[model samples]
Target chain A: MKRNIRLLIEYDGGRYRGWQKQGKNADADTIQGRLEQVLSRMTGEDVQLIGSGRTDAGVHALGQVANFHTDCGMSCGEIRDYLTRYLPADIGILKVSDAGERFHSRLNAAEKTYCYRIAVPGVPHVFDRKYLWHFPEPLDMKKMEQAADFLTGRHDFKGFSSIKRTKKSTVRELYAIDIEKKEKEILISFTGNGFLHNMVRILTGTLVEIGCGRKQPEDVLTVLQTKDRQDAGMTAPPQGLFLVSVKY
Target chain B: MKRNIRLLIEYDGGRYRGWQKQGKNADADTIQGRLEQVLSRMTGEDVQLIGSGRTDAGVHALGQVANFHTDCGMSCGEIRDYLTRYLPADIGILKVSDAGERFHSRLNAAEKTYCYRIAVPGVPHVFDRKYLWHFPEPLDMKKMEQAADFLTGRHDFKGFSSIKRTKKSTVRELYAIDIEKKEKEILISFTGNGFLHNMVRILTGTLVEIGCGRKQPEDVLTVLQTKDRQDAGMTAPPQGLFLVSVKY
Candidate 1:
């Protein structure tokens, strides 16, 4: 009998080559490979877990959802304990639960949220260096917010997506886009039906360009209208992006 | 003409061996080394910087202070700009000032504060994994506080000192010891005139042991009375410790 198990995992993507399996040597070690290894050991069988989405190398996630099928009758606590003990220190299983038979981590998700963090002018804080992008120049929050407003709502985001994106459709419904300024950090959060490959990064890059006065807020609409990748801003670094939550 | 310059330095202690010079690869690459490198580049001469104290390898600092004598007539802003342009991304100089000849980073300090962070049960947070010690067990705050109280005031913490410590006189004034629990993290702060080699780590080890019910709160007294290194608890890992501030 197969039982569906849902897991909320958190990981530092720095050590791995993104979330998927890759070629030999350094690339073979990834979040998915590690998960399968742990599952294989726990059930004495080969288990392949499906994740909600793939994150680029050096990208982090706080509430990434994954699901797997197993015949074990152990409680959710037991599964969580097993993974915690066997998994490397960088990856963790935050929660475990029995999922519905037809539930899918990726297909069943209603919305997703991501956050990009930038540390303003100062010594890069020793404690937070790993989790934030340090920028020495003082950014204009009001300008960034104005650009953010232009990105909200449903639109074809082909201009912001990577060229490698193979998805059939480039359209995504952006529910909200918020730009918040903390003491020394600027947090840009996005909630949307889905994101194209590197869409958030490109969006952040364009907004940052706007904040720095290199581009105007109205340029965002122009870039969207152009639907050309070269017209979009540079892609932000992966370290600054975080998968905050996946809503089911 | 020599000018006394004060620097607020920040570093990620992981890559470096420690804050002091060591022999070969085992030695610390050091925050001091990096600072001297930048200074030497600015002025075509060797530069030596004196820090408030040494933080062992893997230990981080937010307000670590350093002072150097330089012949360059550059103002604080100029020096800051030069370092910001030349320094590596991981290390930064937050502030720079011309200090009086009598000012010293180490000797003029009124108090030094250090924070030791411990992550409670559950998954290791990817963002804070490098900066905290993950402890899976539930800790007793009351017991830990009781043990912490015994450490306050002036005492010869010979038992807590590492065997490698060369300081003949071990008597030091401990102004305060505070234990704070926030969410799933425990922060233990220590303020003192000076700390022995591995003093804070060993003290934290004993406190944690007490919190875990392995040792009584009064056991700290017995450990201090014996003045024997073997009588104390294990030294906590270095990553969990941070040089929080240095008051002048």
Candidate 2:
């Protein structure tokens, strides 16, 4: 009999391609691949790890969730300790416990919160270089906040994504967009039901452009209505993005 | 004619062999070596970059002070931009400014502050792995504070350092030791007039040992009076230490 196990995970994605494992004959350095490899070894059986969502290359996660089925009789405490001790330094297992049979990581996630960090102009970042977007130019916070207003609430975000075509609905509920200024960096966090491909990055890019006076605060409205990808701004780099949490 | 230049620097010392450059023909991957290399090219002359002090390999710094002399005609802002743009991402030049000809980076410094970070027991630290010491054992804060009290104030700290013998007096003024408990980590900061080689790490090790009940809190007094390195617990790893600031 197989037991369902759920995991709370976190990782620095800078070294991996992304979360998903590309099949054989591809660059398969991925979070999922590493998890499956470690779990398979621990359980002495093949394991299929399921993640809540996929984060892009160079991105990071602080509270990612996953689940898997295993036939191993090891106690949850033993499994958690073994996994944490065996996993690479860059990957961490926050929690491991038995889950209900019907629980699914991806299907059950309710919302996600992602944060983007921009180094404040004229500031130096060394230890945080891999975790920040070192944008040196001064930005207008008021303008950025005004633009963020346009992105809040439910909308068709097809124009703000890289996906040229998708059979799935492009509609997503953007619950909130908060821009906060820390001592050395500006943090922008997005809480949403779900984000389309590159939607958060694109939205960040558009808001940044508006903050820098390259675009108007209201331009995001037209981009949303027309659903033209070209109307959106550039896609922000992945290094600055962190999946802060996934709520179920 | 030569002019004096002072630099406020920061670096992630994980990649380099510390702040001071080991002389030619040795491991030259040092923060000072990189700074001198860039400054030499920018000024069209061999530059000697003098840092406030040497941090061991794998240690980090946030406000390290340094100075150099050169005939380079570039403005301070230009020099700052050039150094920041040319240096590796791990090394950062926070500020560049003209200084009095008599100023010395090391001698003129008044006090220094260093911080050590330890991950809380059973917490996962992925993105912050390099910056934290992942000690899973529970630590007693009250015991650690008791140990710290014995180390505070003016004392000959010979036994707490790795050095066997030195003509320079081991007597130093330790102003304060602040232990803070954050959500996921415990931070200990030390402010002192000067620290001997391996002093901070050894002191941290001794304190940690006391915290874990390996040694009694009052045992630190014996370590201080005996002047024997073995009396100390252990030298904490370099990755957990950060040169927070050197104030003049």
Which candidate leads in lDDT?
2
Cα lDDT, model 2, residue A93:
87
In the order shown, the candidates' DockQ scores are: 0.48, 0.59
Per-residue lDDT over B1-248 for candidate 1, one digit per residue giving the tens place of the 0 to 100 score: 68999998777787777777563344228777777877988977777888998999888887799998989978899999899777776676778999998789987887889989999777556677777888667789999988888889888898888855564788878899999988769999999988888899999998888898888899999878988888888899998898888989
Task: Please give, for residues A1-248, the per-residue lDDT of candidate 2 as tens digits.
Answer: 67999998889999998898887434348988888888988988889999998888878888889999988999988998888888888888888889999889999988999999988866668887888887767889999999899889999999999898789999999999999988988899999999888887898888888888999999999998999988988888898998889898
- Per prediction, fnat is 0.48, 0.65
Q: Across residues B27-134, which tens digit of lDDT does each residue of candidate 2 receive?
A: 359888888888988999989988899999999998899999988899999999898788888888888899998999999989999999998876667777888887
TM-score of each: 0.91, 0.88
Would you list the clashing residue pairs of candidate 2? Answer: none
Give the residue spans of candidate 2 off by over 4 A. Answer: A1-3, A24-28, A70-78, A97-100, A213-219, B1-3, B24-28, B70-76, B213-219
Query: Which stretches of candidate 1 lie above 4 Å from their native place?
Result: A23-28, A121-123, A134-138, A163-167, B23-28, B135-138, B163-168
* TM-score top scorer: 1
Q: Taking chain A by itself, what TM-score does each prediction score?
A: 0.95, 0.97
